[model samples]
Target: MIEWLATFLTSSPKPDLLRLVAVPVFAWAAYRDVRTRRVPNRTWLPLALLGIALLAWDIYRASTGAMIGGLAERERFYLRVALSLGMVGSLGYLFYWFGGFGGADAKALIVLAVLFPTFPAYMFPNTALPLTRTTVGVFSLTILSNTVLVGAVYPLFVTLRNALSGHRAPIMFIGKPIRAADAVREYGSLLQTPEGFSRGGLDLDALRMYLRWRGVTLAAVREDPERYRDPTSLPDDPAPPGDGSIPDGGDVVGPETTDATASGGDEAARAADSTVADPADHATDAEAAGADADGYDDPWGAEAFLDDIEGSAYGTTAEGLREGLNVLAAEDVVWISPGMPFIVPMFVALVVSLVYGDLFFELVTLLV
Candidate 1:
């Protein structure tokens, strides 16, 4: 079996097993990218390890004289593999670092380099394209270039589709409009205003958080202990008499005066001046005492600060539709980008290189 394997590896001149492994892996990546716009590490890591193991074994065989290929051929093969791996890895890192490609894309490219450092020898006779036959050393690079060429046509297709659908300019050329409701459900990003000039809408999420922090419910704003308190100005120690305010000096928001604190001296003086109070006035006095006890004078309470920055609908949250009401109407429009996943183009390029050779080579030939 070992002899047979050695003969196969030396005689074939290409990693046929690696090619077989790559087909399904690349296909899975294409599907994952299109559906989720992500390629998990699990998809590429195993394939990369397998390629590395195969290469290591080849090296071991060659060192021990178990490899059947001529010394020159083995050396050339190792050189090609090493060079291809380095070139592909460096390019992938550069692309990822520069934000030209996603991390998944970079990882997939490296895996491709490991798996197919050289083109499959079995394909040579059948490959009709001249570039495929000639450029066996840098198969991954050809795939990368081809992917770029083929991927360019997607935007054109999107533009044409939008034009035919009677969609307007700008976003129309980039991506077609789905119903705002549907768009919110989708993973795509909204291409519209982040927020409005007025208090457009409340983010229920922020409201909920504020409610939780304040320990208040929507049912009873008036009775909550934390209602009149400023969270940023809560004090640990009580204010001394005649001070009539917390140490922090944050006033309790109230209905009456903008400048808070009625003053303990004024309250004492008023109490002394009052001889008799009506039964109805007793309620007012008690309310005033309650306000004094809390050391807060704000009438509006924390509700005045409720105009918080709500979560945006355009980003990861998908909280609300941008211009959703108008978009719900038949005439209005909204724009969104259906995220472009890079793996689909990569898959196409792989197939093209296998069947018709490098796209750039063909283009050059046609031009010449």
Candidate 2:
């Protein structure tokens, strides 16, 4: 039985043998990464050692001009593999710098560098074409498998991870447009769009996407810090009292509150308060004041809400302030990214770079 098993194994192709050895390793690394959001150095350290060992062996063969393991020139092979690994490392850094992947992720890439060759090593120098039709067929099948898995598996994994995170983040939501109060979708966190906000560094698109025009003044507090400081409109925060640059006893009402309170007494006083207002928040405040002036009801207190939310709103209005801010918080409608998808600590691209060289990229890019 042992002789037969050895015979069967030796009879199998080298590419198949290599794959048989590699599949479990890649799978195990992926499993650890998914399970703990980390991959242990123990697993990768061996791989790094393997790379250094392979590199050394190749150096010996190249210097002697002898082929080992039936491969091509050792120097060419070593340089190619090292250069490919370097590319993978560079890609990982590019992603990490942009806020992708955790530290463990880059380490994993380094380890992977030792194992994968640029392009599939199965094809031989004997072949004249850079890629044979047979190779293309095999590559296509592999790519198809990977793409399908990513689409199906990753989302499920994210769902499972989020479920275990214990944060009770929202999963889905119905976006209802409200007029005046600060109605934000809780699940989206700070993931706002940059459409109109590129110029201001404010959250106008965030208001539109998450808050969605739902707003109401929670309070009518006359002495809001916002009034004296005008965070959004004023370029700088109020000078400390020691500087005396800040006016004494500045009215708390902003252009928003002033506009809402305009009918009460003086427009000049309202504008004179001269503070910046975020359109979404400002609209909510002015709407609250307008509603209060007209004897309407409120849910999220206007003064309290404004004091807490950061930044200014742009071009916000108050058509139906009372009804907008009434809906209570729910459990779904988006995902929370500490950073963002664009800024992840670990990404799948590194793995691809490890397995396939520039060819893999050119292939994926063409297909994608």
lDDT of each: 0.53, 0.36
Give the Cα RMSD of candidate 1: 16.5
Best by lDDT: 1
What tens digits encode model 2's per-residue C-alpha lDDT throughout 1-368? Answer: 67555654555334324433444555676655443333556766766666556556545655676644444445456655656556655655565566444455555555544444433443332331223222222332233234334434444555566556553434312112221222221111222122211111222223332121111111221123233122232212321111101112322223234345423333343343333344245445645434445342322233323333433232222211111222112112222232122112123432332244234445566798
- Could you tell me the TM-score of candidate 1? 0.55
Candidate 1 segments whose C-alpha is farther than 4 A from its true place: 1-14, 57-79, 123-131, 134-136, 194-332
Which portions of model 2 show Cα errors greater than 4 Å? Answer: 1-22, 68-75, 118-368
The superposed Cα distance between candidate 1 and the true structure at residue 338, in angstroms, equals 2.2
Q: Which 10 consecutive positions of candidate 1 have the poorest summed lDDT?
A: 238-247
Q: Judged by lDDT against the true structure, how good is candidate 1?
A: 0.53
| Residues 100-168, model 1: lDDT tens digits | 677799898888888767555532232322234444456777788888998898888989888887876
